[model samples]
Target: MQKTRLSASGAGLLALGLLAGLSAPAFAQEQAMDKLKSMRVSGIDPNLPLIPQTGKNADAIKENLKRVKMPAGFAIDLYAIVPDARHMAVAPSTNMLFVGTRKSSVWAVTNRNSGDAATEVKQFAPSLKFTQPNGVCWTKDGFLIVAEHNRILSFPAAEFFYEGADVAVSEVVPQGKLIPVEDESYNHGARVCRVGKDGMLYVALGQPFNVPPREKLKAFTEQGIGGIIRLDPFTGAKREVYASGIRNSVGIEFNPKNNDLWFTDNQTDGMGDEIPSGEINRATKKGQFFGYPYIQGKTRITEYGYDKDPVPANTTNPEVYTEAHAADLGLTFYTGDKFPAKYRGGIFSAQHGSWNRTTPIGARILFTSLKADGSADKTEVFADGWLDPKTRQYRGRPVDVANLPDGSILVSDDFAGAIYRITYTGI
Candidate 1:
């Protein structure tokens, strides 16, 4: 699959390509470091004023409440506020919400009854740092597990609320290879881990650079570290390679009906705007390669020496192609009764917006109707106006999506440092 063709709006795409070339080399080696500083400053606007020095509002939640757009009869409201929170996970059994941060700590919020604010918040596993905790999931037995850099850590869900705390679980370093770098650069975004229906834990390991080839991609897929991996939940046993060749998949979910895995993978950069559109892929089998360094979409890149074996005519392409650099993250299918009948089994994905593009894209929630076989139909914008398309300024960047028991959806914004609840009020 060669890279998707550049799809930016005419002149804007040209300017963006020039800017990316200028910054690529300077920022390439320091990409992770740059992301860290930017994330700490909320990473919303590159041209805006620097983040404030003092007060809770330094990184306060900026609602831009009026700017939000949704379908008729659908109401969007503030769900909760947590400063510096990035990827978040919910444990419905215990009604607990766990939020990960760039500052190397995880906050657990409990007592989240219906229509009530998260009543209690506490920080556990304070000593863990290095890779930001990007993905989190809870086991059937009430164990709270988190993915931090190259390792996974587990603790009891009870300890999150218990005044007298005892750390019952020990962190287990998986018997897998890290992306051999002194600074762990290949561990970018390390998000999207979940316990599959097969009773095994799955984790996504991202690539190091924007679009690295064999030499630059060594130890990270060249040596096979990127893509998804499965491990035993309790003892960290039965480690197996689930899939490979994914660039950076931040959002993943299992289809409730068939238990098949699906993920949204952000495309590689340097290609023109539309050349390499992001993808939604179904993880059908173990060791099934989805291109990556070989091909972008259905096109083959000759420059990377991948033109030898032409992309097969029958090769599997994305189930759907999202807008280029929309930064798709956090996907879930609507299975609840609150929304319209047409929305049943529809896929909802959070677009975190794009920074490298000349014109801003994403920063909204999109809905896609899936067929009975789980293939995508026409994709539509479920929510929008998170970013001012003309000014290229963002009002928010949604990172994750989850549904409440009452059928409402929760979207988490790493930029605004808040979460928004969307409820359908239509008859």
Candidate 2:
């Protein structure tokens, strides 16, 4: 074929068309940023560092590691240095570890080898401002979904796209609409999401009040605030209220053995440290309700329940009762093949040391074995010592737990802004 030589005017037109084509998405991204800026989204302020400082060096992690205690055959080590690392979702297909935060960004933590600490800690989407994009999950279809306080962003082929450049952003739930944009409150809006075995998205939304007023309860119950909301990942079109009456749940997971939904609910506060206990509940149905403002754990609320509406009849009580002020946050079932036979189907969770109690509590990890009927066998401390026993100071606070393919677990510490890996290596 003969080469066609173009005139200057023709070449100029071609270049202009090419430029417009390439700049389209960039222009859209810029427009989106401008809109968010104009709206003055509450939690997107970059100057605000949620935690004091992040990026802990090996020395600091080693010093803190001395204070962590695990089981007799288990060992813990620093897996990655992630800033403000809150909730983590591991993509086995890409070996990409995604860490969410309660501030402006989400981080991709990469470990070259299985046992080594992460060498590369890169921000996933640097373009759009993530306002408390605290909920992160890996969908079965190999997509990543981040549910934030006011928005939800999805990245397609996230692992591969980050190789050439950052992945293009796809809005899963539009900005300023994940919850009521006008009534947006930072109280308990930070969420933790997971792609259910049914190939749908699950997000836990905390109600944002000590107790929502009676008039607000009906709307909240209907909209799923203080509940688990299900979403269709493909279009974000199928959204439903899965559970209700959970006060402030920051962690949720499905039992690998039975696919039953289990979550950690932070019970009502101001009811004193010992009265209203925190919860580890198992929901067998879609519309299950866990007692919250009306009744905390199994006890009727003495402070607010008296002339108010009574506890809803079909409310589900927690399977295991964690102590009040424990602040149970994140959890994962042991599905890896590395641990002993007894732990194959057990649960491991983090307690993000309490702040409201007179004396400090939590700052430890809890374990619960599963019953044959999918109930709790027993609950005990799996890991502890993050809070100094003598000084009553927090060395580190664990926020969430994610298990690796090899059966080891990664626990995120938002207070220290780092991730710790736990493995079994003893007899």
Best-fitting candidate, scored by TM-score = 2
Model 1, runs deviating above 4 Å: 1-63, 111-113, 158-166, 174-183, 215-224, 307-309, 312-315
lDDT score of model 1? 0.69
Candidate 2 has a TM-score of 0.86
Task: Write the residue-wise lDDT of candidate 2 on 1-427 in tens digits.
Answer: 9999999999999999999899997676667555543543323333322222234465687688888877789898887777888999887575668899999888877766644567667776565757898998888877888889977777776766654223456777776667787558969989888888899899898998877877778888887888999988767788999999888999999997788989998877787878577789888879887877678776676654432767778878888888998899999998888988878889998999888888889999998998788899988998998999899889899999888887788899998778988889976
Model 2 regions lying over 4 Å from their true place: 1-56, 303-309
Superposed Cα RMSD, model 1: 14.0
lDDT of 1 at 76: 80
lDDT (Cα, tens digit) per residue for candidate 1, span 1-427: 7886655686688998899999885454244333432332222233322223234542334337568888898888766665555666777566657777655667665545554445555565332233577787777677777777766766666434322222344454441333344436643656567888788888887877665665655456434456788888777777776877777788888888778788888877766666578788887666777777677665555556766756645345688788888888888878788998878788888998886776668899998887877677878898998898677888788888887667877788878766677889984
Work out the TM-score per prediction: 0.79, 0.86
Every candidate's lDDT: 0.69, 0.81
